[model samples]
Target: MDTDYDVVVAGAGPVGLTLACELRLGGVSVLVVERLAEVDTTIKAGAINTPSAEAFYRRGLLPALAAVQEENLERISGFMAQRQGGRGGPVTMPPRFAGHFAGIPLKGRLLDASDPDFTGAGPAGDIGFIPQEPLERLLGGRAAELGAEVRRGVELTGFEADDEGVTVHAGGSAIRAGWLVGCDGGRSTVRKLGGFAFPGTDPSITGHQAMVEMEGAEALGKGWNRTPTGTYAHGPFPGRILTVEFDGPPADRDAPVTAGELQASLRHVSGTDVTVTAVHTATRFTDNARQAADYRSGRVLLAGDAAHVHSPFGGQGLNLGIGDAMNLGWKLAATVRGWAPEGLLDTYTAERHPIGAWVLEWTRAQVALMRPESHAQALREVVAEFSDTVAGTTFFAKKISGVWQRYDAMAAPGDHPLVGGSAPDLELADGSRLADHLHDGRALLLDLADAPAIRAAAEGYGDRVSVVTAAAPGRPELAGLLVRPDGFTAWAADTPAPTATDALGGALARWFGTRTALPTGPRAA
Candidate 1:
């Protein structure tokens, strides 16, 4: 069949770019299109969660991200010193890694490397202050390096999908592809054009944020302002301000936000007449939560904000979108390559939709806890108490950091502990690591026991599944394991299964499609 590309990704943001990179790694031809001529730096998601960070590391992009974060740290320090009188006497600032949930800090102590629960979550280099702009640059550059065509200044005007392929109309040009994925923004035209059902709750509060010269920035202090009316926060820098008004969202949600409107909102929320001298950029957002009822509609699929959107309270939007791209990339590539087993592509929605719903609920819970009412205040106080304890703080850290997330490997195989979870970064006898083995975007039959039987079981899949005989002497709990392309564990055994060949054969067929040729020896050691 003649097609312009294997997949046409509508949107060139972080999610879209990451998806294009993954598809290319899987040997799929992809085209990424964005309406804007350049990357958008106005909206800042300043950090990534552990899983997204680890994904970048596995693809050999972490060192660049670490360099960007180091630069950002120095810039933040300088900004703070300049804003705070430049007095070098122990210039105290908030801890760089202390994240917040519902306006309360999830202290860095809980995320310490010593914690076993947090072990193997991600590389240490990824847990820093990397911002979104540099991340996009890295991802876009990597996608191009892997041979994905990215076309900016081209808008996806419309699309039509049939059984064979999808015809996308964009920028007065028509392009046919085997599939189309909408990684566009919250108000995605592709989503609307595909007739996907979006259902969710409306906004109960409005958030205003801006960088401006203010007269009384000092009184606002270094942290949050939880007043009787609303909440506001002035950061380590004087010009950066955030205000939350519990008033319902504005009538015109699409109206352009002005500095005047933000100033007014700031005064109302903070209950202070802080004079604003100048404004750089201002934007308004809402607590409105929504999700597409289905991620797939025929040949059209959705990811990122196009599939689900919620309050950015916990900074979960970007992380969620990244997870979606990674999860869908290999399955979609397998389908395009004519090797995907039955029901493999469908698992993308089944596995991810519930995770999307959980994030929406998480944000909703935060909104409720942040309400400026007596009951909400009492609840917040209780949660604050919990945050002060090790168990409570660790629980919150696990949830926020995404270290404890696990997907269900429905009807897959052995009920090993790591099933449906990310494969731990295991150290091998050769001093190499597990993630280092997966750089090529192929499933792994990691034979930790150096079991010849396991190697024999993986013989026929060839490049689709790589068998690795790594002596993971530290992880005595795992004799062998099967990990999917996206790093989630598919099956595991404490010892070789009684019927090793039959069991491994079932797993290979279920995940990587039937084998094409005789087995090559262990792809890596």
Candidate 2:
């Protein structure tokens, strides 16, 4: 088969765009095909969580993301101000926005903004509230800048994969590539065509979300409110309403969501006769959790909603999808470049599958606690007490926001603290931060001890692994650490002596591929 591209990504959403950018940065050509002619203006997920926000920050996508967030806040603030001006002279303070787990309000972030674990080594906080359209556009623009081709209005009708490569049929044409990834979303054609098994629980409830002009908006309580019928939440944006009905999914999911439907759903859930005059956009979702048995089926793979899907509770779906893109991008790039070790591509499933399972369980557990039964309310009361405590809040915050997410990696003997954990944002000697060095999308070897052996070992890989000799006095754990491109530490040694060089070499081979045992000069950055 004639291969026309290294990878043909189905879906121009955030996950596909992120994967395309990562592949392009790794020198792999990517073609992203989407069925939609324009960016989906419908608001899907509302916020980028801490971990996903940090991922965007590492790729230098945060500046534009932050700008969009600020602009949105301004727009919402102006709307609120206009509403308040005509009513009275002054009003009490509005409720502060915070993260939530299930429908339970967090009151405040679990992770502190100043915490290194939360902010990484970056200057920004762990969360951003940019709407989905701008976020998708930002990722799409970044992917194009990195030479990833995105063609809209071309849908992946079907695909065929064999030992050599995959042939994707989209827009009435065949495009061949070494790999094909479906980021097309929950009802993924690539996933179905690739024959990946997606198994999980069925939906117990239907969720309705809409942005509209409401006549009885003042009747509903501010922020999230739990009623005996169901739960409802309102946002800062005027007429943005969220409602959940315990009824199973709608009969016609593909049918256009109308203002009347939203109004009815809101009335049932909130027990208020809220009138929706106009609906800008509306959609329905369910808690039908399911994950592909394998992320890859021969040469065809899945990511984002294609790979796993759970309830949008805690806003974890978008973040999990972005995480999938980040984790698979470099590994797939390595495979395409012919430098990846055996089973390297398989590790994408091995590593991410468990996380997906955990997310499914997380949402499922939340659903159990959210039932309108008396037992569930009692359990929620106990959980609420726990959430008010520091330990409880911190645990839930890290879990929900993904700050405590860790992967299992081969640890060096006398294991370093940060191994297999999300690498911290180290403050380097030259007034720069550790995340600054990862912008080029390469494995990073930080030599805080100024170890010639470690630096020389890294030089063997050349540009594949960047060696930075910087002093991170505050972080003694940075003595010598090999950070993967996705910002996870593969190996670390506190001493960083010549004896430790052998271990570092092994980790480099394990992650960045085998290299000639040469004593080259140190690379300075």
Highest lDDT scorer? 1
RMSD per prediction, one decimal? Answer: 2.2, 2.6
lDDT of 1 by residue, 105-176 (tens): 776665454567577754742465767778898898899999999999999999989999999999899999
What does candidate 2's lDDT look like per residue over 8-105, in tens digits? 99999989999999999888889999999999988698777666877787777767887998787776675566556546454333222256666777
Indicate the TM-score of model 2: 0.94
Q: 301 in model 2: Cα distance from truth in Å?
A: 0.9
Q: What is the TM-score of each candidate against the true structure?
A: 0.94, 0.94
Our model 1 lands, by Cα RMSD against the true structure, at 2.2
> What C-alpha lDDT does candidate 1 achieve relative to the native structure?
0.83
Error of 1 at 9 (Å): 0.5
Question: Residue-pair clashes per candidate, as listed?
Answer: 1, 1
Give residue 495's lDDT in candidate 2 (0 to 100). 82
